[model samples]
Target: MKKTFFSFLTFFIFSFSAFAQNSVADEIKTLSKNKWQWMADKDVDKLDKLFDEQAMFVHMGGSWGKTREIEIIKSGFIHYKKADIHEVFSPIIIDNTVILLNRITLLAVVGTNEVSNPFMVTEVYVKVNNEWKMGSLSFSKLMGLN
Candidate 1:
């Protein structure tokens, strides 16, 4: 009787933990999607609110910080009219925090030079203070995209 009770107790705990993990993962995905939408709409205020103070953005060309990224948005260089997030894989949550490896394909027009670039992007998100934030980003132009 004791062995069966212990086995059931372990199974119950495992099931609850799995359910909680899935719930957190789904919340992270929704939060990430909202951030991308904010970026597409050029909502700098929201963007600023979405990033941690020490967040780092690494472009294919180089790197940028929170202030610089917001400045670039304010500069009106890239207008992201349409964005399609292809995949977010292997999202991990540890000790009330979540991390995701995301890949997105995007189309944007450069307002300054009248140039359009279609690109593939990789992003990472981390949950801080119960809010998911963009922790890092990198992008490369899609080849044969003219």
Candidate 2:
């Protein structure tokens, strides 16, 4: 009887933990989508809340902190015209950190040229004061035209 109860308790605990993680993952995914939209729209207000103070953004050209990222978006240095999200893979959750990987076709204007490219975007979120804030964003270009 004790063995059965212990097994059930363990199963319950793990199930609850997984459920919580899934919930948070879904929230993060939604936030990621919203972030892309905000970037396309050049909505710095929303982006400001989503990004952590010390967030880092890595691109093919260069990497910079949250301030520079927001400034770039605001200044139209690299406009995110669209993000055609192909798929959002399952998130990796470790304690207060979550890492989300998304495959997408990004349309943007760099200087005076418009370009489209496929990329795997890695987004890292960390929980701070009971809120999730994006800490890092890295885009890896994919080969071939899609």
Candidate 3:
């Protein structure tokens, strides 16, 4: 009786933990997709809420902080016209931090021209006051094999 009870309890605990992790990953994935949509729409208010105050953004050209990123988005300096997400890998969760990887083709307007490129975007989110806020976003251009 004791052995059986112990085994059951252990299984239950492990199952619950796995479920929690999966839920957190799903939530972050949804948030990430929403963020891309918001950027394409140039919804600064929504982006502001999603981005942490100390957030950092890294692009192929350069890197900047949250305020400057917001300004750039608002000013249409680097407009995110669209994000065609090819795949979103499972998130890596460590305590209150989650890192999501996405393979996408980004369509953007820079200066007077619009261009599209394949990239692997890494998004880092930190849990603050029970809310997930994006702490960093880095885009790496993928080289064409052909």
TM-scores, in order shown?
0.80, 0.95, 0.97
In terms of TM-score, the best-performing candidate is 3
- Could you tell me how far off, in angstroms, the CA of residue 83 lies in candidate 2 after the best superposition? 0.2
In order, the Cα lDDT scores of the candidates are 0.73, 0.95, 0.96
**How well is each residue in 1-146 modelled by candidate 1, as lDDT tens digits?**
99999999999999999998998888777877887787778899999988778878776557889898888776767666566766677567777556666655666666554444556555566667767777776676777754
The prediction achieving the highest lDDT against the true structure is 3
lDDT of 3 by residue, 49-131 (tens): 99999999999999999999999999999999999999999999999999999999999998778999999999999999999
Give the least accurate 10-residue stretch of model 2, judged by summed lDDT: 137-146
Candidate 2 lDDT over 21-121, as tens digits, reads: 88998999998999999999999999999899999999999999999999999999899999999999999999999999999999999988999999999
> For residue 97, what is the lDDT in candidate 1?
54
Instruction: List where candidate 1 sits over 4 angstroms from the true fold.
Output: 111-120, 140-146
TM-score of 1: 0.80
Q: How close is candidate 2 to the true structure, as a TM-score?
A: 0.95
How does model 3 score by TM-score?
A: 0.97
